[model samples]
Target: MLCVEFFAILFLAYVILSLSFERFLVSRVKELYKSLIPTTSYINSINQAEDIDILTSNLQKLNSEKNLEIELLKKEQDYRREFIGNLAHELKTPLFTVQGYVLTLQDGVKDKKVVKKYLKQTSKGVDRLIYIIKDLDLITKFESGIASLDRKSFDIVEVVRNVFELLEMRASKDKIVLKFDKEYSKQLMVFADKDRIQQVLTNLIINSLKYGTERGVTEVSIEILKENKILIRIADNGEGIDEQHLPRLFERFYRVDKTRSRNQGGSGLGLAIVKHIIEAHDEKIFVESKVRIGSEFSFSLTLNQD
Candidate 1:
């Protein structure tokens, strides 16, 4: 009987110890599961943060590209507007002139004098059209960067003299005195395209004549600056340009007085061409004007020391 009781007590103690150990293991497993849940949540949050960052960067880049495209589109639109405006103005002049002459001829006034006058007017219109087309072609070539300059070293004074001689007839007809004051030596040479320089000079001189007062003296002076550049000034005592009109002087087809410009036989491209030619030579042009006081147009080009 005693042996039996002792064995039963030992069995009971082993069963209690095993049950307590099982409960402890269950609690430990629950704690480990709770910790794992928080760790998994933290990992998901980190992934979401990375995704947000990536999306933000992409959005910024896309916005930047969109702005750039908008700017390019705006510039293209502006260019188109300017081109169309110039074209219409250019076409309108010759068309109007031709229409006027044709209508006059159709008026049953077939006198020889009337016919001759109409024919001359028609010819002038055609010539103006041709000039406009030529200038437009030149401007297109210049803007497209395909125009080549016939670069050579030549005496600038000689070129100026040639321009004066070439346009002397027109100046004489207009009674505009064309004079050149040599502030530098007669042997001053500049490296540039001879024809282009002559074109620029002629255009400036003609412009001076067109706007100048009757019997007004137009002066062309060349000065050597300390910066090793040469300044060529074309000054005229014309019905001076308005302060507001000065800024747009170099713009294509821009005219201070439209009717007057037309009457004076300007295509409004002369100054623009001058601007481009000077720029091609890596030079700059400037203008100073006072209303009714006269205007001075000047350009500077680097001297060819070599």
Candidate 2:
């Protein structure tokens, strides 16, 4: 009986030790959990904040890019609308004129004077239409690289003299004087497509005459800009182009004067064509003008080296 009692006491002591150890272990676990929780939460919060900032930045950048694209598309749309409207207006004017003259002739108005007058008027309208179409075609060819340059060496002074002589009657009619800055008796040889250069000069001189003040002077001058390039200038003491019109001077079909007299005006493609021809030669062109003071159109050309 004593042995049984000792065994029972040893069993009780073992149970108490096991219970105490379990309580101590549970307390240690709870403390460790409390210590690690704030650090884990803080790290998680930092990671989340960084992720949100990046997402917001990316979203804002995307929105800005989208807005820019939308603005560009709107501009293009507006430009296209304006272009179409101008084109239709330009073509319709001469067409209507021609049609009216034809209908008048067809109505059997039989006087020879009337008939001749209508015929001439109709002919002028047709010529204007033709000029517009031809100029448009030439610009297309230039833009497409289909118009090849025929470079030849020629005396620029002789070319200018020819232009002066050709327009002598026209200039005299307006009482306008056409002259070179000085007598270029010596050869001013340039390498370019002679015909195209002549055309450029004709367009510029004619433009000056058309818009020039009555009895104004249109002058051509040359300067040796560098060893390889010469500057050719066509300047006029006439009503000058406005500042706003200067930026788009070379745009096709652009007109400075909305009510400019068509009788004395051109196809409105002269300056655009001039720009294309000059650019094709890998050259530069510039315009300087002021209201009333005058206008000067200058371009550089390569000197003939051979």
Candidate 3:
């Protein structure tokens, strides 16, 4: 009988001790949480029962959000670094070429043929430099909201015809023909910035002409997509862009064939400008390409119902 009583007392003592330890641990955890987030409204809402699980879950959530923000900031930093590097490289090439030509002229090697060649090369370099600077300035204006669209009703087909006339000589030089997929009604009108849209058409056609195979064809077509939207597509039958290059094709100074791009003598800002102009009108642009086939550039514009 006495051993049974003693055993019961010991069991009671053990139970009390366990409860005390549990209470102590919970209290310490609450204090730690308060220290970590003393001013948090979440702490104030916590009950005295002090569920550690709740606090832990909230902490984990906050931590995850902070980590995500940090990652985004890192990506943005990397992009800016790459952009600055590309800009410097593009500008440096033309500047150095012009400098070299000037030095050659200064060396007193004044054969008429040599002088004419040097002068012509120098002029081309200057023109490329001017184009790059102007394009950069234009993009900055677009981003800063200083460049605005003067929206008006204009015939898109007429715009395409004008662009063809403007680029006819260059296209002919490459034996690349520009044509429409079908005869469209001349009254098809779009609501957009006419001059900006013209610029976009000119850029895409010029790009097609530059990279197209000899005697290739570039066709422009229009489709009425919806009640208020129309899609304009420019497709080429020359060398198509690789899939990987399609994404960055509209980026500034990005060239699929870097050597060919340089030899082609362009400032490499044309597509980028085209992208900005279309986006300024709140429209989207898209590209489709296949290796050894051809590429197409398309954009949507609001229809002018009036």
Candidate 4:
């Protein structure tokens, strides 16, 4: 009887110990599994990642962004080089002309007529230099956001009429008729910087006159656009630009024909300045042209409600 009791007690003790060990082993296994996997609320630092696919995806994205940044830097460097080169070229022409004329006078030219002629030419060169400098300053101000606009309500129709009158002599010289598409009797008031808007109008109309065919018609038109906007367009029956030229046409000093005449005498920054002015007003400018057909430059403005 004593031997049987002892054997039973030993069996019970063995079973209890086995069950405790199995429960402890299961708890240890659960902790190991948790360490191997990530929880939904887990976050990893930049240098640390638990999942291989997530690491690969993050690396690919970083590489793409780096490549994009490098490409942009390359483009910007090229553009800077081009802009500097163009500026030098534009300034050199007038500078050389003025220097040549001044040297000729310094050589003691005898005839008053010859001296007067050279002086006049020298004066023209100086004027051109001034024009270029002013345009450059204006555009720089615009690009740097240093320019200020005196925004107010003004009659746009009167402004166009005034621009036409101001350029009347130049237009008549080439027999280019500068007129409105239709007569506007009532005032078409707009909210903008009056002087700056005038400058925009003048530049656009001047471009039409300069590039238009002799005796071609240059017309200004204004139409009411939706959302309290007004559209102004300057159209000319001129030698239309090629399709490719229109894209970079507003770029400063960009020319369709590099060999085109400079005798037309412009600062070459007109379109660029016009673009800046319009954009400064939070507006967009557009151009359309067809070879051998014509070109139209247009922009929109906020119509003055009051």
Report per-prediction Cα RMSD to one decimal: 14.0, 14.1, 3.6, 9.6
Clash totals in order: 0, 0, 0, 0
TM accuracy, model 4: 0.82
Cα lDDT tens digits, model 3, 120-179, are 999988988898899999988987889989999999999999999999999999999999
Which numbered prediction scores highest in TM-score against the true structure? 3
Task: Return the lDDT, model 2, position 218.
Answer: 98
Structural similarity to truth (TM-score) of each candidate = 0.76, 0.78, 0.83, 0.82
* Per-residue lDDT of candidate 1, residues 1-306 (tens digit): 999999999999998887777656545543543454444432233322234454456447857998999999999999899889878978897989998998888886658997998889999888888888999999889989999998888888888888889889989998988888645455777888989988998888888888888888889998889867899999999888888988889988889999888777776899999999999988999999887778899998767787
lDDT for 198 in candidate 1 is 89
Residue 183's C-alpha lDDT in candidate 2?
77
Q: Candidate order by lDDT, highest to lowest?
A: 3, 4, 2, 1
Name the better of 1 and 3 by lDDT: 3
Among these predictions, the greatest lDDT belongs to 3
List candidate 4 segments past 4 Å from native: 1-57
Number of residue pairs clashing in candidate 3, backbone atoms closer than 3 angstroms, sequence gap of 3 or more or interchain: 0
Q: Which stretches of candidate 2 lie over 4 Å from their true place?
A: 1-67
C-alpha lDDT score of every prediction, in listed order: 0.83, 0.85, 0.88, 0.86
User: Which wins on TM-score, candidate 2 or candidate 4?
Assistant: 4
Better candidate by lDDT, 1 or 2: 2
